[model samples]
Target chain A: MVREIYQAVADGILVGGVYALMAVGLTLIFGVLDIINIAQGVLVVLGGYLSYSLSTRAHIDLFAGLLITIPAMFALGVVVHWAFIRRLRGAERTSMTLLVTYAVALIVEGVLYKIYGANNVQLSAPYTTASLHVAGFYLPWIYVYGFLLAVALVAAVYLLLYRSRFGRSVRATMANETAARLVGIDTGRVGALTFGIGVAVTAAGGMVFGATNAFNANSGYDLISRLLAIVILGGLGSIAGALAASVFMITLESVVTIWYPTWAIAVFYAALVGVLVIRPRGFFGRKEVRAQ
Target chain B: MIGERGAKAGGLVLLVAAAVAFPLAFPDPAVTNYGVFAMIFVTAASAWNVFSGYSGYISLGHAVFFGSGAYAMGIAARDWNITGAAVFELLPLCAAVGAAIAVPFGLIALRVRRHTFIVITIAIFFIFQLMAFNFSFTGGSAGLSSPFLTWQESVYDTRFYYIALACAAGAVALSWLVRRSSFGLRLRAIRDDEDRASGLGVRAMRVKLSAFAASAGLTATIGAVWFYYVNQVQPQTGFDPLFDLTVVLMTFLGGYGTIAGPVLGALLVEPGTLWLNTQPQLAGASEIVLGVVFLVVVLFVPRGIIPTGGEWIRRLR
Candidate 1:
């Protein structure tokens, strides 16, 4: 029983890393743009589809496929910003973005449905099925690799935010866009690039997700809810908060499933509500809105 | 003042007359079906507008409120023996149940920042749908059906249609009243600037909570009436994202923050959607079209159908 519990926790942490990476993209967009991209969920699905297409049609490995999918997703993000997001402004910005992003989601969902035909597809790598036994607990090799990728990406994101000159500009824009512009930072360019980078990371998450689950075009609906919950529970624009919340939520659900399989899902949402009621700003999130 | 009030009443009469007469004149069941669906959607949209448009809170997952009302009414009518009550009676019961469930949910969820609030609400709805899917008592994915009460076959059928009409009317009237009331003013204030509203001696929490409760209550009533009209309610069907999307789309297309915007959206788009649905080639393209419509509306008339119309009216005056 203890060993099983340990395995669940181990598995939870591994998968939670990937979720954290996906959620960071969502948080970064919200933090920088003041626009909640409902399309992020669908974008992840898009990422999965891209990877799937590359792996199946081009015979690229799932990890190797990211080499192509990442930049492609980044470009798509820039186009989305120019096409839809750039128009939103003033008091109507938030509500209007919801509508616009939702439209983007539906469009992607439709195209995916057109191409994929609503069938479930999974990425079948040898590592996906292989397990490692460590400390008397079994861990999937895919999860381990996914976790490592997540850590590297998160570290790179941290470096981009803190260590690099571009990172300083991005942070300045996130803190105060008007001030960033006044200081010679091309805030518009930063916004577009941040959005693109936010979307680009989803390709990695998509790869891991495709490896883990049987997904179709419609799977985004469920995935969106979980990702949204993670971001919200972490606090909307806080990357650290998203990371913490993802671990907390996934672990809770994973651990709870051991005791009550049917009730595990409900428990995660219930925890979100409970946590918010107690501390609305989330575990590490600040209450102030980020500069767009 | 009395004359103005009378004029408003006359306008309402004219509007109702036109709606009732149009179907009879057009003599198209297809258009009437759209009208019926539009009226239903208007109820949901008005309910959504209370929390979203009025309070300035974007809820990505209003399906929770709609689903609550649906599941509660479905359970009450299916497992219990409650059926054939006037929609007024059934509606209030559903509304109360919905409010009761929503208050705690709102209390818990409303504490979060704006974007998180939206996400958490969606998650909550997801849980509701998943639970309905997994549980046998909720009929799993197939869902529950109202038993064959004698009323379903009799005058009750036509009466149910009238009930829907009455409910829609109530929702529109309520939305108008709330939009003009002091509560509505405070809600708008909160939406525009929560901190400023708090500074101005408004208890933002109380106002938002009230809006949440009222919206949940109204939408729940709509849900109960919906189940009564449909005869059967399934988990997947009842909790479908399409329903939520329709409500959001209608509210926006009509105009967000305008009491009448969602109604106007229903008027314009619902019939078009119904017509589009009939096209063999466009069968699955309804959602795509809706998305396109949303994009067009957001990019062009961000304020919404009624608000923009109001602006045009002001310009003409």
Candidate 2:
């Protein structure tokens, strides 16, 4: 029984890494732009589809495909900002962005449905099915690699936000766009790039997510809710918090799955509500969020 | 542009007359079905707009209340052995259930600001959706079906149409009354600036919660009628995620916060969607079109039609 529990924790932690990858971009966008991108979930799924296309059609390795997909997603993110997000102004900026992003989600989803049809597709690499025996626990190679990548990306994002000059600018923009603009920072360019980078990371997440799960165009609906839950639980603007909350929540769900498999999903959301009620700013919310 | 109060009254009379005459004039099952659905959305959009639009808390999870109302109707019918038209009596029960869910849901979700409120609403929504699917009494995945209605087949759509129409009227009237009331002013104040509103002693949480409950109850009543009209209750249809999106789009299309905006949005968008859905070639393209339409409306007419048009009228005059 203890072994089984350990396996669930291992599984949860591994899967949590993929969730962090999906959620970090969402948090980053919120942190910098002060607008929630409803399209983040769909964008992650879009990332998966891109990777799938690359791996299947071009015979590219799954990890190697991210090189192409990330830049492509980044460009698309910039365009999304320019066309849809840029025009939102006035008192309803935050709320209007919600509508605009939802519209963007719909468009992307529609385009995806038009291209992919209704069938579910999964990414395949030899590593996807292989398991590594480590410390009496069998961890899938894909998940293990995914966990490593998640940590690396989270750390890289932290560095980019805190340890660099551009990071300083992004943080300044986040702190106060008007002040940042007064300081001669091209806040618009910063927003575009931040949004782009936020979306770009999802390429890696999507590749892993699509590899692990069967997904269709509509699969984004399911992912968005879970990603939103993770982002919220981690504190909206905190990437490290996202990573922490992801592992914690996923492990909790994984352990619960051991007994009441059917109830595991409900428990995931229930835990979020309970946590939020107790800590309205989430686990590591507000004070340590975003900037550092 | 409608400039005078008398002109507005005349327009309202003409519009209601047209709505009343719609199902009777058409009588086609499909056409009446469209009317029924349009009316359903009218009620739903109005219910949704009352809180989210007025209060500026954009919920992507209003479907929780919607689904709850649907399940309440279905469960109440089964547990009480009610059947036929008599099941209509469960409207209050469904409304109460919706309010019951909303209070706790509001208590938890509304504690946060607008953005977090949206996220938490979604979390609570997933909880309800999963419960409906997993719980044994909720009939699990197979879902519950309402008892068979004894109404004639030809008149079935018409009867549901009238029921939905009445509910839509009640909902719209409720919206009008609320907008004219101090509660609506307080909600708008909260929307405009929560800190200032609370500073002015509005009791922001209480006002928002009350509105949330009111909106949920209204939405639930409409959902119960819809469940009865459809004769079945599946998790997907009852707790539909898209339902929230569709209503939000409608409100945005017509104009958010304006009383007539959601109604106009529902009357237009619902029928258009139904027509698009019925199209053979465009069958898979409905969502795409809806998406495009949502983008167009938000980008070009973000303030929505009623407010924008009202501004246009003022400018021209």
Candidate 3:
């Protein structure tokens, strides 16, 4: 029993790492642009589809496929911003973004359905099925690779934010957009670039996610809710907070599944509500969140 | 002033009478079925507008109340052998169940900011959906069939049509009454600016909670009626998050925070969706079109049709 519990925790942390990568992208966009990308889940699915096509058609390795998919997703993000998100202005921008992004989600989901026919597909590779025996627990190679990739990308993001010129602009914008503009950071460019980068990371997250779980276009709906819960529990725009909350939530869900399989999914959300009731700002959130 | 009030009241009565007489005038089962759906959507959208449109707290999880009402009716009918008039009488119980769920749901979820509140609502909604799928009482994923009404087909349709119209009328009337009251003013104030409203002693929490509870009750009543009309309940249909999204879209498309907006929205969108569903070549086209419509409306006409039309009329004058 104890070994099974340990295995669940081990499995959860690995899966949670991928969640962290996806959530960081979401949080990054929220932190810099004050826009919640409601389309994030669909974008991840798009990434998975991209990877799926590349791996199946081009015979590219899953990890190697990110080199192509990342840039493609980034460009897609930029185009989306240019076409849809850029024109939104004024006090209702946040709420308006919610609706507009939902529309974006719908369009993408429709296109996916048209092409894929509502079938669940996963990225397949030898590593996906292989497991590593570590002590008494068996760890899947894809999870191990996913976790390592997540750590690397998260570190890269941290470095980009804290150690580079672009990072400085992003942080400045996050802190105060008006000030960032006054400092000649070209805030518009920063916003576009940050959104692109935010979406680019989804390639990695989605590849691993697709490999781990079978997904169709409609799967994005469930994914969005779970991702949103993670980001919200992690304090919306906080990077490290996203990391902590992802692991915590995934672990809790796994443990619950072990004892009460029925309550696993519900517990994920119930914990979110309970936490928010106790600490409205979340674990590391600011007192006054960016209001819509 | 008295004359103007009388004119408005008379107009309202005329409108209600027209709506009540609509299905009878048509006399087609298909048309009446469409009427039933349209009326149900009107009530649902109006219920959504009561809280979200008034308070600017967009709930993506309204299906929680909707599903609760549906499951409540389903359980009562299946377990207690409820049928016919007894099942119809259970509408109040469904409403109560909805309100009961909202109390705790609102207390916890309402504490967060608007953005976080959306997340909480989605979370709670999924939780309920998952529970419906897992709990044996809800009959798991297979769901529960509503008891037979034992009426003639046309009579059943007519009965449900009237019931749906009454529920929709009640929702709209309640909304009208609320909009005229001080409580509605508080809700609007919260929507405009929560901090400022609370600073001015509006008791934001209580006002929001009451509005949420009221909205849930009305929505649940409609849901219960819908369950009866459909004669079945399942997690997918009963707890569909997309249903909540559709209601929000309808309210927005019509005109949020306005008395006549949601009614107008439901009238237009529901029938349009039904028409789209009938199209053989355009499978999955309605959703894509609705998405584009939502984007176009939000970008170009955020104030919605009624307000924009009103503005245009004033400009013409």
Candidate 4:
């Protein structure tokens, strides 16, 4: 029984890493941009489709494909910011951005449906199913690689925030956009760049996700709901908090999933409400700086 | 300028008279169905506006109350072995159920800022959807059927059309009352500036909660009526993500807060949707159209049609 529980924990952590990678960009955008990109889930699916096309058509290795997909997604992100996010102004900016992003989501979903149809497709490679047997546990190679990449990218992002010059500008904008603008930060450029980077991370997360699961265009709604819950529980903008919350929530879910799958899904969402009821502001949310 | 009080009164009487004679003029079920759906959407969207539009908290999860109302009606009809017109009595239960859910949903979600409120609502909506799919009593994805009614097939659509029209009228009336009342003013104040509103002794949380509850209850009652007309309720049908988005779209497309805006939006969009969906070649095209309209409205006319168009009229005059 204990061994089975241990296996579930291991499985949970590995799966959680992939979710953390997907969630990182979402939280980062919210932190700096203050706009919840409702389209992130669909963007992740778009990334997966991009890699699917590359792998099947060009026969590129999935890992090697990120060299192209990540940059490609980043550019798409910039376009989105330039086109929609930049046009929004005044008190309705936050809500309008959400609506516009959702419109973008609908358009993307429609396009994906037109192109991909309703059939489910999964990413395939030798590593996708290959497992590493470690102490009575089977860890899939894709999960292992995805976990390592999540850790590295998270560290790199942390350093970017704490150690780099542009990082300071991003932080300044996050803290107070008007004050940051007053200091001649070119908050527009900062917002555009940060939004791009936030979306770019999804490409890598999408690659792993496509490998592990069979997905269609409609799959994004479920993914968005889960990702939003994780982001909130993780305190919106906190990177470390996102990582912790993803692992904790997914672990609880995986553990419960062993007994009753339906209940696990319920608990996953219930935890978000329960935690907020007690903490109100989430795990590591800002103490005094309320988002206006 | 056609803005005089007598002109407005004449227009109202003319509109009511036209609606009363609509089904009699065209008894075709297909045509009246368009009317039925349009009115149903009007009620939902207008009811939604009373809270989200006034409160300035954009929620993408009103479907939770909608679904709650549907299931309440479905389960009540089944458990009570109801088979006739008596099932209409269950509308009050649907309203109560909607309000009951809203209380807790508001308590937890409203504590957060506006942005987080959107997230909480979406999260809770998905949870309810999951429950409907898994719970044994909800028929476990097979869903529940409405108690069969024996009304003549020709007049069948008329029954639902009038019910929906009545519901839409009530919702619009409520919206008009709330907008004129201090309650609506307080909600708008919170929307503009929560801290300032509370500082002025508004009891922001209490005011927001009541509005949220009122909106939910009204939406749920309509949902119950919808279930009756549709004859079945599935998880996907009852708790639709698209339903939430579509309501927001209609509300935005017409005018966010004005009484006539959602009514006008529903009139235009619903009939067009029903017509377009019936076309065989237009598969999956309606969503793209919806998206384009949404984008156009948000980008060019974010203030929505009524407010912006009203400004244009004032300028011209």
Clash pairs, candidate 4, are: none
For model 2, residues B26-88, the per-residue Cα lDDT tens digits are 988988999999999999999999999899888878899888999999998999999888988
lDDT of 4 by residue, A1-292 (tens): 7887898899899889889988888989989988889999998899899899999999999989999999999999999999999999887888899999999989988898888998999898899989999977889999899888878877877889889999999999998889999999999999999899988988998888898889998888888888888988989888887888889988989998888887897899999999988886789876534335
How close is every model to the real structure, measured as TM-score?
A: 0.94, 0.97, 0.97, 0.97
Which ten residues in a row are the worst by lDDT in model 1 chain B?
A: B152-161
**Model 3 over residues B1-317: C-alpha lDDT tens digits?**
89879988998899889888987799999888889999999999999999999999999888998889999999988888877777888999999999999999999999888988888888988988988999899999998888877899868788888999989989998899889999999999999889889999999999999999999999888888888888788999899978987998898888989989999999998988898989999897777888888898898888789899989987997
Please provide TM-scores computed only on chain A for all of the candidate models, following their numbering: 0.96, 0.95, 0.98, 0.97
* Each candidate's fnat: 0.61, 0.70, 0.69, 0.65
Q: Give the 10-residue window scoring lowest on summed lDDT in candidate 2 chain A.
A: A283-292
Candidate 4: which stretches are off by over 4 Å?
A287-292, B1-3
Q: Supply DockQ values for each candidate.
A: 0.56, 0.57, 0.68, 0.67
Candidate 2, residue B23: the lDDT equals: 85
lDDT score of model 3?
Answer: 0.90
Candidate 2 regions exceeding 4 Å error are: A287-292, B1-3
